[model samples]
Target: MAKFTGDTAKKILANEINVQTLLHQHPEYQEEVLRELSIMKGSYDLKRIQAMMNKYTSSAKLAGNLIYKSGFNEKTVNTFLPNIIKARMALHLLEHASIAASAQSPTKNVRFNLWDGMVLQRLLFSKGFERKPVSLGLFNFCWKFVLNKKILMPLVNQKGIYCFYSKALIRELIRLIGDKKCLEIAAGDGTLTRFLNDAHARCKATDDYSWEHYITYPDFVEQADAKAALFKYTPEVVLCSWPVPQNTYEKHVFKTSSVKLYIVIGTRNPAFTGDFGAYNEAEQFTMELNERLSSLILPPSNENAVYIFRRKEH
Candidate 1:
């Protein structure tokens, strides 16, 4: 019987020491291992789960790896893997969505479906990604965004998913802005800007770069938070995608005198996205959901719409 130390736990997590082999070598350590597994299952720390999720190919593979390493019982593995897999799927969907949204030519219009399985498999588990995890996919699809949305909704509620914009929506937005200087704040990878820019709309993508975990901030995405960006750009039109619920930065957009139109791409449900509290408090602007524009958001399941806010006359 050997004592299980912090070093042992660290080695277990690092994969420096294989749990099955370790337990086989020292059966007495089983109780200690079980305790550690319990802690991991209970914590479900976002960073830790994300790290694990990145290293594996899919939810099934990830769950299998965790179960194999922990050498846990069937009951324990069942309780642990389901939720962890769901979170992992959500993260994967967001990562791929960002990649799809940032496509060089958004007008080509991407859609997701069962046909993408082969491409998805290769990107997720092929040789090129053996040394490093696949952060971006070659294409983006909205139809069947992921194998399971049951796994995606939990994270979407907490951290909203990025949706690809339609050409129609982009054209309409361009028509509305019609020469007004535009700025997109919190633009994850500048997906909307890619479409708007391609359409010759004068818009710049800006973000605080806080979501580096899920989004790889490209060179084109200007590194500025909403308030600082609003102050610097002082554009008449402002655009944002899926602003966090009860956010503090959007309020500044309302206060900025230069902004005449504030466009937000998000769900109507306050619980899903956008700073609703700020929207309600802005007496100076009138908010309306553009149905024609909303239909352009891919997959329809996202329930996302283009919200146009026009400043009321004094």
Candidate 2:
């Protein structure tokens, strides 16, 4: 493994070093970079991360106290909002550093420090505030809390970070999808379908289980690709969450004869998710943002949208 100096870590953090190119040339180098950033005691990068944790600690405490005292009422909301923002900023610093070191080699985990674990545990799985699979309250808590993004974005590989499904989004979808059989393709973990089923919506979850490294495919999520699921289920409404950017599979959704309404939960940023080319080329459908559903997609800061595609009335 190549020795990653403090200067090298600094260069990576500054975007001076082309990590992608470096990784392409020497894939083993990524491990070294991750080690230096996360494991090397007294390293500059580690110190920077520790400093950010300190800031996050102070801010989270202040925000948590305000919420505890006033129950996050209107008057207390504004007062603690600044502290929440500060916490987010502090966590972002760690996120940036983790991404800078590990994005190129995505399969390798970004190990968080001891302090990071405590902060993240409180943010994700705190008692009395535990929102099991998905909830608007949970999403709001995560969005308002800084440590949420830090723990989620950095600790895991890219495959782990999918769209956060909110109860509001699911409820809105249930209303829009009334009477229509819905199917979710690429259904990682099958959590969404579990929620939808609980809401009594007729939706089946299916996936090829390709991302098994990070995603746990429940038995409810039938093992199949997008094309296979669409053909077998033959649902009227097809749903997908964060389809791989510019992937070939999603075009199959447009081709399926029974799919009249296709809903995609993803970022508007074309480079981030979904195949815009397929969406544009699929002339038989009229695609537009479902404004109400879009607003319901959780965490608020993720800037995700719920896109609706209806077969044109020919």
* TM-score, every prediction: 0.55, 0.58
Best by lDDT: 2
Whole-structure CA lDDT of model 2: 0.63
Clashing residue pairs in candidate 2, if any?
A: none
Over 210-241, each residue of candidate 1 has an lDDT whose tens digit, in order, gives 66766667799998878788889899999998
Itemize residue pairs with steric clashes in candidate 1.
Answer: 111-141, 112-141, 112-142
lDDT of 2 at 153: 44
* Residue 92 error, candidate 1, Å: 20
Candidate 1 has a TM-score of 0.55
List residue ranges in candidate 2 displaced over 4 A.
1-151, 156-159
Please give the lDDT score at residue 171 for candidate 2: 78
Instruction: Give, for candidate 2, the lowest lDDT window spanning 10 residues.
Output: 10-19
* Model 1: residue 286 alpha-carbon error in angstroms: 0.5
